[model samples]
Target: MRIVIALGGNAMTAPDGGARVEDQLAAIGAAAEPIADLVLAGHEVLLTHGNGPQVGNLLRKNELAATVVPPIPLDWCDASTQATIGVTILDALDDALGARGSDRRTTVLVSRTLVDRDDPGFAHPTKPIGRYLTRDEAEPLIDHGQEFVEIAGRGWRRVVASPEPRECLDAAAADTLLAAGYVVVCSGGGGIPTQRTADGRLEGVEAVIDKDLTAALVAGHIGADLLVIATDVATVIRGYQTPTQQPIGTLTAPAMRELAAREAFAAGSMGPKVEAITRFAERGGIGVITSLDRITDAVTGTAGTRVVPAG
Candidate 1:
């Protein structure tokens, strides 16, 4: 089976913050065990990772250097992160796969996801990014007309648009790698958002695409049999952390969507993931949302929320 796994940003970076390179190495290296296991187990594997923390760090550097140098655009920051994080994943996979004595080769393809130039997302920059600041610091940012929001106990950060990804420019790359038996790693930060001109040329845009949604698009384009979203949780829990909390198991796409309509998942957190998987499930592909530790088990049907057809 061909499997496309989307590793969440927090899953690959230091959960504590700072986007430290050493910690990223450690975290990504830990992920290699499961990725290699899948390859060793004779399944074609492709990888896509998130870079929320890393990009936020880069944006900070861009802001500090604005006076000395031209400010970097959002698309360029996304590109910068894709290269940095792509190298890390490739390096970690190489070390781990080599230790296991497998001859599988790995490669990274910088993906460009297509988004509508007139997407409603551009009208509303609702997705937050970058470092958090205290109210005093945040209030000062408003002088420059930057949008800030106070998220729970966390301080305020700049928000940006999150547009829907209409297509993946490198969808064919995955198929080519799968046919050649290579473990392909691509699509960092939901890929560098791009748009087409009237003359049919591609150019970068100033927005980010939802990583989970982009992963689903790539999985569909590559004709993956399974889409495994390796998130921070073991399973989908309804009413989480309360008296009536419940673990979600096998269910059809429609059933899951119904739960979503009733607000079972938090929009900023688990909502995108569930919606992405539900779409994949409805398209006749198996979807699993589980921790990276249980990825192999999830494939074997022993763990995670296995989304299937109701009939």
Candidate 2:
């Protein structure tokens, strides 16, 4: 089966603030175990990941490097973060495959996704970016025309417009890699949202694309039979966190629409997952949503919310 798996960011960070590279290597190594099993089991896999924490860490590095060189834009920082993660993950997968006595090849493509220049999301700028800063620290950036919004009432963060993605800029390349029997990891952090200039040159935009939405696009582009979204939760819950919350095992597209209308999922959380699954199912795609540990089972259809089209 051709599958696209979107790994979440929390998988990389521990409870405390430490983010040593070796520790992250160990964490991702644990996460990639089931994935390697899938590869060994003969499923064609394309991996994508979220870089929220990674990019934030890179932004701090940029700030520190300002004394030696000028800090780069957030979009460029995201691109660098993607390369860092893709390289690290590819190395781990290579090591894991070798340790398992398999000779499967894994590759990371520094992917780029195309976004509509006129997307309404550009006007809203809802996706947060950069390092979290104290009010005093954020005030200067705000004064200098950088966008900052208060999150959780503790501090401020940069909010970038998370526009809808139109296409994976490197979809053809990813497909080629997949066809060549390589486990390709592409489209990290929604591929560094980009647009075409009037002269037809692609340029980076100062925003993000919803990673789940991007994953759906990648799945469809690759003709994937399954798109498994690995999150912190084991299953998507309706009326989440409420007294009457219920876990959903399966849902028809229409039923999902009704729940979505009632706002069952939080906007910054599970809402996008539902929307992404809906889009994938509506487009003749199959999908599962589950915790990271349950990923292999989710792919085998024994676990997770198996979202299918409404009959």
Instruction: Report lDDT (CA) for all predictions.
Output: 0.85, 0.83
Candidate 1 displacement at residue 282 in angstroms: 0.8
Task: State the lDDT of candidate 1 residue by residue for 1-311, as single tens digits.
Answer: 99989998656777675468888888898988888888899999989988888887777775566446555777888888888888888888888889999778888888899998788988888887777877776664555456778888988888878999889899897789889988898787899999998888999977878899999899899999999999888998988898998888988999988987886688777988998889898888989899999999988888998787567
What are the models' TM-scores?
0.92, 0.92
- Number of clashes in every candidate structure? 0, 0
Report the number of the highest-lDDT candidate: 1
For model 2, how does the per-residue alpha-carbon lDDT over 1-311 read when each residue is reduced to its tens digit? 99999988756655353567866777788778889989998999999998877777777775556446555776787789788888888888898889899998888888788988888988878777767788776665565566888888668987878888899989999999999999998999888888998889999988877889999999999899999999888988877777998888888777778878996677788888888888898888777889989998998788888788778
Which TM-score value belongs to model 1? 0.92
In candidate 2, residue 146 scores what lDDT?
66
